[model samples]
Target: MLLKRAIGVAAGAAVVTAILVAPASGAGQADLDSAVREAMLAERGAAASADFGTPVLAEPLVEPTRSNDQGWAFGTTTIPAPDVEHAGPHTAIFVAHRQAQGWQVELDGTAEFVEAVERAPADVVSEGEKQLFARNYENSRVAVADTGLGLPWAEGVAWWMGGGPHGDSGQSRPFSSLDFNGGNGQVLSAGAGRVYKSCLRNGSGLVRVVHENGFSTTYYHMTGLTDLGDGQPVAYGDYLGRIDVGLPCGGSTTGPHVHFSLLRGDSHTKVDGQTIGGWTFREGAQAYGGYAERNGTQVGTGGRITNHGQGTSTPTGVVESGQNTSVNVRSEPRLSAPVVDELPDGSVVRIKCTARGDFVDGVWGRTDLWNQRDVGGWISDGFLYTGSDGPIAPAC
Candidate 1:
C-alpha cells in the first residue's frame, strides 16, 4: 500500500502528519500495520521504496506488551524486506497513541518518543514497563561484554557445531552467533527470562529470550515454536522451539539448525573469549572459522559439543483429517510416489519440514504443499492441519 506523509512544524519543531488514511479508533492489526508502514516511509522518504521496497509486517498483531489505559501502546514489529543486504528483517520498536483525530505512531531513536516515554505519568505507563523500555533502549546503544547463557538444548546432549563463531547478521564482524545441528531438535531456553516471537507469520517465527541480567538471546531458523504469548516467563530448559531450516525472517540455511546468538540489550555481542554452555569460544581470524575449548577438549567447526544446559522433550502435533480415516505417507512429494505407511486421523506427527508437490483436495482443502515427517516420508498438507493455510515449516 502506498502511503504519503508531510513533515510540518508543530510548536516550532518537526512533526510527522499523515497525509494518507489514518487508522480509526480501536484499530486492528491491519490498521496498525499501515501505521507502521507509513511511519517507516516518512522516516526514509523515497529511499525506502528504492532500497527495501514496501515494508510488510511479518506476523499478525497480538496484544501490546506495553500499553496503558490511556490508549498508549508500545511494541515491536518485524518488517521483512525483499532486499538482500540485510540478513534479516528490520525490527521496528514503536509507540502509538490515540488522539481525538486518530492513532499516531512514533518510532524509537527519535527525541519525541524518548521524552514521551520518560515523562509519561504512572497512570499512562507503569514503572515496570518504563524500566523495561529503558533497558531495551540502552541495550541497543551499548555493547555487552559477557553473559551467563548456555547451550540452547538439553544437558549432556551432544550437538554438532556446524558453523563456528560468526556474525549474527551473517557477516564477518560481531561474531555473536554459532550454529548447532544433530540433536533431539528441541530448542530449550538457555536461562530464565521472558520470551517473545519475531517475524512470526503463518505459524512460523523466531524466538528471543530476555534474561534478568539485561541480556537477550536470539534463536533463528526454527519451526513448531511455542504458543506462549509475548513477555511470558520461562525457566531454564523450557521448550522454546524446534530447530529447522525455516527462514521465517528472510535468510538462507543449508540444513536444520539453530543460529544462536547472545545480545546485550538489543545489540549482538561478540562470543569470542566468552564462556557458553561450559565452552569458551575463540575466533580463528575468519568468520565461521573458530574453535570451542572446554577442560582441555578442543572442538573445532563440524565437531560435536556437549550441551550442559537443561533439556526438554521434543514437540509434536496431531494430524487432523476430520474424517475417521487415514492418510497415506508417500515416499516422495508426488501422489504417484509409493506409499510407505499410513497415519491415522488424529495421530501424532513429528513434522520435519515442507516441500512443493502434487495438489490434493482433502480435509483442509486443496494445496500443493506437502509435509515431510521426521519418521520417514511425505503427506498431503491438505490432510494435515498445522494451524495455517500456508506452509508453516521450512522448505524441505
Candidate 2:
C-alpha cells in the first residue's frame, strides 16, 4: 500500500508470488542464501548506525520463484526489531541477477524492492515471466545521463564545497553552489544540453540546461550570459556566464558563487538521485549527510568536505586482486615515471584524477591515487572498481 501510493499506482493486482509454480533448485537456494546474508549484513549495519537497533531474522527466507536463462533469483526476508513497541518486522524483498563474475544483489530495499516485485506478472509460467524479469532488470540498473558531466568550473579552478542543501533561500534543498571565493568567474555547463534562460528571477540570472536524459541542470546567480539563445545546444564545459551578486538572485549570501541544482523529470521534483563527481544529491539533507554515496560507499553521519582541490576525487577504493599482487604508483602519469608508492592488494586509496598513459597489459588510462597523507600518484585504472561512472575526476 505504501509503495502503491509512492508510485501512484493502483493496487489489487493479482499477487504474482502466489502464481509461482516451479521452485528454486538446490544450487539456486545456496546462492540465494549467500546473497541474502550479504544483503542482511549491509542493511542491518545501516539500520544499526541510525539507531534503528539490530534486526533479527523474523522468518526464514523464502524464494518467490524459479529463474530462467536470465539467471535471476527473487526472495524476501523479514527482519524484526528487538523493540516491538515502535514497529513491526520489516519485510525486504530482493532480486539478484547472476553477473559474469558472480551473483549481484540488484534491488534490496523495502518499499522500492516490493514495488518492483509486485509489478511482476501474476502468471510466471509464460511470456509474462519474461516481461517481469526484464522490468526488474531495468529497474535494478542505475540511471545515468547519456553523456558524462564535468565540473562546472574550468579545470584547476577548485571552486567546490561539500554538496548539501543549497539554494537562494538558504533552506535545506537539493543541489550545491560552488563558492566563488568572492570574485566573479566564468561558469560552464556541466554536460551537453539545451540551454534555457527564460525563468530568471530575483535577479538570480538563472540559466537552465536540459540534458538528453530529461534531467536539467540550472545555474543561478550568474550574469553576462553567453550570446547563445534559448534552445541552443551547448556541449559540456561550454562557457555559460559569470558568477554575480545581486538582490535578483533569491537568497542572501556572503560572496558571489554559482548556485547549481539538478532536477530530474522536471523542476518540481527534488529527490536525491543525481550524482556529481561521485557525490549523490541529498535533498533536504545536510552536506555529507546520510543520503549521499561516494563511489558506491555510503558517506556516514558527521562526514564533511575537507578540501575542494582541483583534480581531487572522493570516495575510497581498494586495490583489487588479479594480474599483479601490487601496482606501482608513479609520480606522473607515465610508465617511465618514478615510483612514488606501491599499493598492495586490498589497500585503500582515494582516486584523485585520471590521465592517458602508455598501455600496460591493456590498461591505457591511469588514475591518480591519494594516500592517507594526501600524497598523490598514478596507478592503472584497470585494477580499481570505483562502483561509479568510470572515472569521476578530471583529466590531469
Q: Which candidate is the best by TM-score?
A: 1
Model 1 CA lDDT for position 215: 66
Predicted structure 1, TM vs. truth: 0.58
Off by over 4 Å in 1: 1-31, 38-69, 81-86, 99-145, 309-396
lDDT of 2 at 290: 40
lDDT of 1 by residue, 1-396 (tens): 112245666899887556433566566556666765566545533322333334442332322456676767766665454434335444545566655545566654444555556666665555654565566555556544335566888754567898898876556357888988876799998887777777776556778776666567778878899888776678888998888877766757778888888766434678898777667788778878889875455789998776543211221334666765888999999989999998887675666778999999877788999888888799888887543456545577
Error of 2 at 376 (Å): 16
lDDT of each: 0.66, 0.47
Q: Please list the Cα RMSD from the true structure of every candidate, rounded to 1 decimal place.
A: 16.7, 20.3
- Candidate 2 residues lying further than 4 Å off, grouped into runs, are 1-147, 155-157, 172-184, 199-204, 271-273, 283-396
- Across 1-396, the per-residue lDDT of candidate 2 in tens digits comes to 211111111484423111112224544666666655555444443332232233343432433444556666654443333332122122334555554444554343233443444544433223432333344334334475321445576532334343344432233233233233221378888777666563243444457665654445667657777778544678877899887753232234445666666554312234355455445545544432344455344443333221112122444445564777787777776678899888787665665556666655523234433222135777666655443335445555
User: What TM-score against the true fold does each predicted structure earn?
Assistant: 0.58, 0.39
